[model samples]
Target: MTITPLHFVGVSALLFGIGLLVVLTRRNAIGVLMGIELMLNAVNVQLVTFDRVYGPERLDGQLFSLFVITVAAAEAVVGLALILAVYRSRGTVAVDDLHELRG
Candidate 1:
């Protein structure tokens, strides 16, 4: 009935793999952003798991996870805003089409 670090690690690995696949296969900018978010979440899961395993006895894992969630929220907002601007300017959200930025 106890959750182990190994369990959390396995879940994190699965999420990382799925996120990698999404990044590799999707061409839409939004899809890529989602993949990046997924990967970040996976990293957060690992960090919290480690903190729980070895940190002081004050539930630091949950605290760090909260900070990560906050940062992720800000990142998502900024990233979506940028994506919206690009879509408005370029009329497309495809990753391949973003090369127009190259000078």
Candidate 2:
């Protein structure tokens, strides 16, 4: 009864799938950003799992995961800022309400 890397991979896959679904189905920009964050977290989990299972001597996997985390943070900040700006201008955050680009 021990945890394994395979279990982490399976969970990561499930999270990625759910994240993808959320990104695809949600009309709100914030919801889509949340999905993207979930997907990024799944990737971080896989990176850490693989590092623990195979690359204990090297910190490459963990380092990469940290980089991903940093990027995800940056993305969330910038994305939320943009969403806020849009909402302020349009009065709604619905994706469908953003029809100013119809050309």
Candidate 3:
């Protein structure tokens, strides 16, 4: 069977849902970050699929995906750094234990 745009959208929605579930259920900082990445990738997939359907001659979707990747990479770096620092100081990466930072 040949794949269609609907297939891509279905897969993207599934991926986004999985990522949202992970983000909501995960306690570890790294796990949450991973979930965010998954969500971002899902969005990228949707962008590309729509671009293909609407205007295959343009590179807008690919360009936007690339920008998202760059932002995601930077976010990962900063998030990891914060997580590392918190783990070093607090001895845990659990979200519940981070309330100590609250004023």
Candidate 4:
């Protein structure tokens, strides 16, 4: 049988769930950022799939996905910079070790 929208949606859901799990379980800042990126990619997949199925005449979905990618890139850059600064200052990137930010 040919591929379907349902399949794409299921894959997206699975990806999002995996990303969520990663974010919740990781103790490292870089791992959390990777999870966030995965979640963003899942969203982009869903957007493009739906757009392909329902609005093939327009590029709204693709455009939105591109925007999400751009945002994700910016987030990665900023996140990595922050992580680097934090590591330099605290000598670690573990989330649990960042107790200074809780105050």
Candidate 5:
């Protein structure tokens, strides 16, 4: 069994495009957060693909990907917390509607 770098790049590109579309089109804070996550996952896929293709010589990419995943998880927690706080304070999760900073 073999996987080509082109395939990984194509998948990563697709995921990145989808994430970009989501970020551009969504108004909800949670939806925007999900877009950011998708973008991060796309980058992770590229990192893992490069690591696998380059063997031991490219271990740093995989290690960085692991760190990225960890950071992404922490970001999700913190981002959700902020979103909740914003919702409580603003009474809405729409990014445009949160301008007043008041509920």
Candidate 6:
């Protein structure tokens, strides 16, 4: 069978679902970051897929995806820095361990 927009959407949904699951269940900071990244990628895929189906000439979807990628990069850097700081202080990267940061 030939690949279609529906297929892309399906895969995107699956990836998003898996990412959400990871975010909900994982206790590690790094794992949760990875899940967020996965969810972003799924959104990128859907954006491109819909753009392709609508009209590839405009390339609006590609541009939006690029913007998202830039944001994701910034998020990763900031997130990793915070995670590292937490790990340095607590000696653990678990999300639950971060409660100590509260006043």
In order, candidate lDDTs are 0.89, 0.92, 0.94, 0.96, 0.91, 0.93
lDDT per residue for candidate 2 within 46-87, as digits (tens), equals 999999887568988999999999999999999999999998
lDDT of 1 at 59: 76
Writing each residue's lDDT as its tens digit, candidate 3 over 1-103 gives: 9999999999999999999999999999899999999999999999999889878689898899999999999999999999999999989999978775566
- For each candidate in turn, the TM-score is 0.83, 0.93, 0.92, 0.94, 0.88, 0.92
Each model's Cα RMSD: 2.3, 1.2, 1.4, 1.2, 3.1, 1.5
Off by over 4 Å in 2: none
The true-versus-predicted C-alpha distance at residue 74 of model 5, in Å, is 1.2
TM-score order, best first, reads: 4, 2, 3, 6, 5, 1
Of 5 and 6, the candidate ahead on lDDT is 6
Residues 33-71, model 1: lDDT tens digits: 899889889989998889878976877777888888899
User: Number of backbone collisions per candidate, in order?
Assistant: 0, 0, 0, 0, 0, 0
Q: Would you list the clashing residue pairs of candidate 6?
A: none
For candidate 3, give the lDDT: 0.94
Q: Which pairs of residues collide in model 3?
A: none
* Per-residue accuracy of model 4 over 47-91 as CA lDDT, tens digit each: 999889876689889999999999999999999999999999989
TM-score for candidate 6, residues paired by index? 0.92
- Error (Å) of candidate 3 at residue 52 is 1.3
Relative to the true structure, candidate 4 reaches a TM of 0.94
Model 1 lDDT on a 0 to 1 scale? 0.89
- Model 2's alpha-carbon lDDT is 0.92
1-103 in candidate 6: lDDT tens per residue?
9999999999999999999999999999999999999999999999999888889578988889999999999999999999998788779998887675466
Candidate order by lDDT, decreasing, is: 4, 3, 6, 2, 5, 1
The CA lDDT at 50 in model 2 is: 90
lDDT of 5 by residue, 67-95 (tens): 99999999999999999998897788998
Best by lDDT: 4
Candidate 5 backbone collisions, by pair: none
- Our tally of clashes for model 3 stands at 0
